[model samples]
Target: MNKEALIALGLTLEQADKVIEGYGTTIPKSRFDEVNTSKKQLETDLASRDKQLEELKKVDAAGLQTKITELQQENAEAKTNYENDLKASQLSSAIKLALVGKVHDSDIATSLIDTALIELDTEGKVTKGLDEQLKTLQESKPFLFVPEKKEQKFKGWDPAGSNLDKDLPQDIGFNFAKEANSKGAPAEKALNPWGQ
Candidate 1:
């Protein structure tokens, strides 16, 4: 059934496989074996070259650690900048909202806010120039000036008369037990009925 067995019987092997199956007939045995061995050698050589290339491209531990540290530092700086920018944006937006109907356009509002924030401190407190700009804006556009909100002061809870003591029995009394401390002071203790 195979070509090699037929060749051993002193008969030449004829075409037995179809060309559509990607196999060629009438190939010499020696040639096929040589091609197969050469193909395997080429594959092995390619794998070896690929491994060497990978070794060349691979980073050392020190280089990789340096890159990681650099990326971490960059990320930290970016985070800090983003936080600062976000805070500035919020401040600018608050000012713009205060100047809603006064400015002719948004650009004017932005410019006014920027001018007011020129001397803003690191804590975002407007320490200088903000009040003057606000006053100027207020005088020019009185409707846009919003008065500062007055802080509401709250009084804490007070135990007031609820007629609680008025309706209680007049003969009622608190009988607390007392103990002698190391300092010889009469220290009050709870009136424990179980003698605990």
Candidate 2:
């Protein structure tokens, strides 16, 4: 009999082997205990990490929403400012254009009225006190006069058949088909699909 059998029979291996003849059932249980403990610890860690991830996602979503709202408000304000500036610039240009030949002192009030009309036509009546005062002066102006024409200086002209023409070869008409076939035969079949 084996020593394990002897121990199972409540005797020392030597003593039980002398009295019995079978082996003992002696499988170790410690490995299973350790595995169970490790598994429980891993499960707990995974649950904690999952919870933290969910919370972080919530915070990110809230931050993105706030950013979106802020950007939209900024966009609206920029559009409003752009429109206001555009109107002011157009009104100023129109007034300057309408004041071209008018006298400074005679009918200053009438000139001012014409200036206001030009501004109204161009910028749709969004006016300030300064704009009103300018319009008043423009309307009060008296004599209407023609603006003088401006003189321009002429640059030298190009000569016929220069090397500059060589740089622009396409401007020189080269009839390759006429050279090939003489009497203006219908343009030879295009050399390539795009007729290069």
Instruction: Tell me the spans in candidate 2 whose CA falls farther than 4 Å from its real position.
Output: 1-59, 103-119, 122-196
Clashing pairs in 1: none
Per-model TM-score versus the true fold: 0.35, 0.30
TM-score of 2: 0.30
- Please provide, for model 1 over 104-137, each residue's C-alpha lDDT reduced to its tens digit, 9 standing for 90 to 100: 5655546755453455567654456656676776
For every candidate, C-alpha RMSD to the true structure in Å: 17.1, 17.6
Q: How far is candidate 1 from the true structure (C-alpha RMSD, Å)?
A: 17.1
lDDT of 1: 0.61
Q: Cα miss at 34, model 2 (Å)? A: 44
- Candidate that would win on lDDT: 1
Give the per-residue lDDT of model 2 (tens digit) for 71-133: 999999999999988876666555554444543433443334443344353234434333555
Give Cα distance to truth, residue 115, candidate 1, Å.
9.9
Model 2 RMSD in angstroms:
17.6
Q: Where does the lowest 10-residue lDDT sum fall in candidate 1?
A: 172-181
